[model samples]
Target: MNKIIYIGMDVHSSNFTLCSFEPGYGMSEDKIFGQVQFKDDLIKNTAKYICNLKSQRKDIDIVCGYEAGCLGYVPYRELTRSGINCKIIAPSTMAVQKGGKKLKK
Candidate 1:
């Protein structure tokens, strides 16, 4: 059986950027999925996208991370309810340097 892991997502009010990483498969190492834009509200669109990605990748474990922002907890709730594991990260967590901008401790 082929095992795939890790999915990174960059989300905004208008669109979502997705990148999938697989350890064992060379073919999936550099694969880039198309970006999806949502015309509806952020919460609804995020829920829809999570559901769709879960359905599409049933065999693989799907882990998603998005920056913590004004969108609130709706996205996290929706993703969890849809059975996709997600983490709400601070923008600073993705910073290249150790001390760029600090979020409240």
Candidate 2:
């Protein structure tokens, strides 16, 4: 199977922070990709970022995700419509791995 670029985002009304990880890139956690403003070109800008990454690493595919919040499902719907693979994870349902920092001794 092809390597997957996993993008996780921390979104807000004014802007958002994106982080990316290559599952096969060792045990390191996700790293910051960049931040983007929430504006008229949000969708276009976000898509372009992913496209740029793909351009650099043609061997990988992108799969992004973020917790649902005040903005509702509009972003999810729009991104999917634009051919981006995204998933909405609920905060309550999100969990850290057993050995992750938060759950460690």
Cα-based lDDT at residue 105, candidate 1: 17
Per-residue lDDT over 17-83 for candidate 1, one digit per residue giving the tens place of the 0 to 100 score = 5555556455544544545555566556656765676678678666677778866676788778767
Query: Each model's RMSD to truth, in Å?
Result: 5.1, 4.7
TM-score of each: 0.61, 0.73
Global Cα lDDT for candidate 2: 0.71
State which candidate has the highest TM-score: 2
What is candidate 2's lDDT per residue for 1-105, written digit by digit as tens? 667878776767767667776653567754555445445466566777777887897787788887888878876887788788998987767666776532110
Clashing pairs in 2: none
